[model samples]
Target: MSIATSVPHPAVETARRFARSSRTHDGLRCPNAAFDAWFARQRLVNRFEVTPVPFSRLRGWRFRSDTGDLVHDSGGFFRIEGLHVTGDLGEWSQPVINQREIGILGILVKEFDGVPHLLMQAKMEPGNINTVQLSPTVQATRSNHTGVHGGRAVPYLEYFTDGSRSRTIVDVPQSEQGSWFLRKRNRNMLVEVVEDVPDHPDFRWLTLGQVNRLLRRDNVVNMDARSVLSCIPCLPDEPAGGAYGRALHEALRPGSWSLRSDAEVLHWISDLKSRRELTQQRIPLSDAAPWRRGPAAITHPTGRYFRVLAAEIAAANREVPGWTQPLLEPAGRGVVAFLTRRINGVLHILLNARSEAGCMDVLELAPTVQYQPCNHPGRPPRFSRAAEDPARLVYDTLQSEEGGRFMYAESHYRIAEVDDACPLDVPEDFTWVTPRQVMDLLRHGYYLNMQARSLFAALLALA
Candidate 1:
């Protein structure tokens, strides 16, 4: 880690104080009143209202047919198409058309005090309760990120494209898969900058440790930041910083889980696949039992889970915030967790064999838990219980940042560890794997979900 000349940062002391209180080993709690007060002063107010627009009237975009399929474009940037697929829960005749969306999410880091600090923004999206959240340095769509619409410049975009003065930690530019809802994919990156960079009021430089600390609090780090952080790659030979950093490095290092032969892991996967697998059912939106078409969007009959709504955004912060688009809004918070345990002195993460309607493949490895609490209040949760209970060794829990692109999408993320006593006779749908094994799976695509990848990236940053 390296940096340019240091400037006096007023938030550093506050960041350190909060970091000390929110240690991973000690578990997490809300920050003190002073920090809360300071945090409250930072806000992003929406100056424009989002009004629903007809699909035919959408400017700079159009719907076209391709090989009997429908695709959409905004004149420039990536395109969206509907994919017909059925999940394990669906019958052969029922297929859901999942919207395929693609975008970019990147982060810029600089070293401070021999430790890496991330450059984050106090950005706002239409669906946030807090109005603003700590987001990635650069989170934009292909259109905005590429300046196709001729909007304001995205901050720190040059470091990613110019190929100058940076260390690329996570360069996974990939797509996402989770068919129950919105289908999205992004180009994710995490880089360390070594040159001088100007600071802005909306921008703050916080150590990776500090960022993880803030993550414990509600609505702090945004989804884009989490997703990008999860992509960070941890090389076995990389030098970790001070004692604290080394401890983080060691936590992610191979426990007994890594010593297992590849054949054993494959066998485990095989056994799990045969015994337990996720199943889903897809039907026409019109025939969906729980959903209804409202005047402006498709929503749950009870107004729960998620709803699709259109908005007309107007903002000086965006090149064309004054545009209309459709977004998804959730009824309440969602959860994304990674369950871990030490097997033979090696750390093993618990991954779920999840099936999404939009996934190219039928199943992929997901975090231990990724669910909308309001959508399934009666069902017994997955590893969510362990992730929420600090006594269960699940200290990595934190509320998700708002998905600015989404109407109102947010989730909490956690990484919890279970002891042998927790139960070796777990459900067949789950498997314990080493961090390295998971990273290898990442390269193959669709094996790991974006939420899971974000947590892994955060773990790598700790080193």
Candidate 2:
């Protein structure tokens, strides 16, 4: 839990050089001009003429042929689906376009002179306005990693699977594409190289401090990188009177923020579970009626939760950003937050058992709040009624979501401290658990969704 005092990394200058020479666009820098041009050339055209079809007849999505019978790959990897999710908080009248893939998102770490440095990539995505941003060392779909697409294999894949030499810092399945994706998860991992490894031009080694500075900006770090970074544990050393220190103060004294105790919070959760209910049912896309059909996309009659649109993208920096593809767009910005309280000197987070139509399991533990602005019901009555000072925050930052693929991807991540003396009321759908306990549950797969995992990474960075 402690990082020893150390000097600046030797590669700090190298990282700076990479950042400076990169092409700047809307504050996001793309280090590779070819990649930028490649992305710019992409031609995104919405095909509003195509007729809507059944989920089983989803075009372009591949199905498995088991014993000569075409079947959905339920256990293979990820699948595409049409989801209609409605709850007391919000209702989506339209069928949501979703991707339920479990990809791999990993970070490579190495220590020099007792200092830890991370290897990041300046990768390009089709939906990114800036073209390229700092990404994880290894970000690839199951097909890419498995060479199904006949592309170069993901680098450092062995670091995660090879156990003899690599030391695992964090390895867990974190959710992605939360707003539109039906429980799309990724295997997020951070591993320390035990021996010397080759480096790539697209990747740069950066200190945690350097990464933190970049994270404060908009669309500078991709979602895959942010999710991986959020899992990092607290450092051994941190500057005094910083945001992390302030957040700790707020968490320790609910009185400072006019917040209730652990007991009161539990009671509120109980009330929420008792009143609100989420009901979901699977139906064929063709039968999902009242949806207006367009040549390019399928949309709800009201356009509330999301819409499926086709675009032809031609990016200057993308290897092949010039193709037409279908994408999902949400109605508003999302929020992912954690409510933390110190239990006998250890911080324990309160998590909710949330479920999505595409999730493999019935329910998985999620953050205190993971919903879009339109979907969120606002602060609970008890929390809204409580008095609070703004100064007692441990971590509060508005971070952008995935930019390249998701339309209007932005979210706020915050951690607030409350008094522990309030009533210990509990809710059937919610429980309080420590970070360590959550980490342990992560090994079970599908326990912690992507947003919760990202907050965990942010907590580590801020701490």
Find the candidate with the highest lDDT and give its number.
1
The residue-by-residue lDDT of candidate 2 on 122-153, one tens digit each, is 77665554546678988876655776434356
Q: lDDT, candidate 1, residue 413?
A: 65
Q: Once model 2 is optimally superposed onto the true structure by TM-score, how far is the C-alpha of residue 352 displaced, in angstroms?
A: 2.3
State the displacement of the C-alpha of residue 253, model 1, in Å, after optimal TM-score superposition: 2.5
Best by TM-score: 1
TM-score, per-candidate, Cα-based: 0.72, 0.67
lDDT per residue for candidate 1 within 182-291, as digits (tens), equals: 44567677767778998766666665555666666666777778776554443333324654344344444433235445466567655655654444443334455445
Task: Give the Cα lDDT of each candidate.
Answer: 0.57, 0.55
- Cα shift from native, residue 427, model 1 (Å): 3.8
Model 1: how far is 50 from its true place, Å? 6.0
